[model samples]
Target: MPTFTAAAHGGPVKTVLVGRAHNELVYHGDVLNTTARIQAQCNALGSQLLISEVLYQQLEPQPAGQFARRGQLVLRDKA
Candidate 1:
């Protein structure tokens, strides 16, 4: 079975084009990196989805049992 992971964050990002043809559009910024790092943790955490605290806080209140706290994770390239 194929497993998937997800993470979210709200912030600005810098967009740029790279490669010899300069046709590849890329999103570059801390927000993107942070989200990716969080997504990567899904395998280790054994969860289908992992969301960042910032995104969780931005969400509307949910049922008491809807979301479980997984605690803080020390992501790569982050202090």
Candidate 2:
């Protein structure tokens, strides 16, 4: 998994896969919350992996160069 920086958290965090387990190290509250937020951000930005749009607009040369046109995406949100 990639360690994407969250502007809200102000550091790097890695997302882990989720599974049915009741161990602290195997599955903890903080770990689960962070991963959820990262997934939401990635989905909102329409990328497989992503940072916030705020961060993207501030790049020197603009990291947008690294992304290719994957075509327009349509997302469904719960009401």
Candidate 3:
């Protein structure tokens, strides 16, 4: 198994998710969850990176149209 490292750039987020090809498993964990959320946000906003409010705090006056505020979202059960 290959381990992946990820970092968020915009908002205040504690965790992130990511997905990878050539992997048997689909939902790895919060990492994967984050990846999905990022993808969804990108589709909605048409950007590359999706950051949380916390991250945005660190980077003020960030590039516009790159991030969208995703208010508290309830994630589904993780197995």
Best by TM-score: 1
Q: Which 10 residues in a row give candidate 1 its minimum summed lDDT? A: 2-11
Q: What is each predicted model's overall lDDT from 0 to 1? A: 0.87, 0.45, 0.51
Q: Model 3, range 1-79, lDDT digits (tens) per residue?
A: 8633333633223433445654453333455455555545554455555565545677758677665676754434422
Model 1, range 1-79, lDDT digits (tens) per residue? Answer: 9756788777889999999999999998889988989988888888888888888888999999888898989898889
Report the CA-based lDDT of candidate 1 relative to the real structure. Answer: 0.87
Positional deviation of residue 5's Cα in model 1 after best superposition, in angstroms:
1.5
TM-score of each model, in listed order: 0.80, 0.30, 0.33
- In model 2, where do residues sit more than 4 Å from their true spots? 1-26, 51-79
- Which 10-residue window in model 2 sums to the lowest lDDT? 70-79
Please, what are the lDDT tens digits per residue for candidate 2 over residues 1-79? 7655332222344545555663333334543444456556564565566443434456566465684543333323421
For the record, the alpha-carbon RMSD of candidate 2 to the native fold, in angstroms, is: 9.3
Ranked candidates, highest lDDT first: 1, 3, 2
In model 1, how many backbone clashes occur? Answer: 0
Cα lDDT, model 1, residue 49:
86
| RMSD vs true structure, all candidates | 2.1, 9.3, 10.4
- Which candidate achieves the best lDDT against the true structure? 1
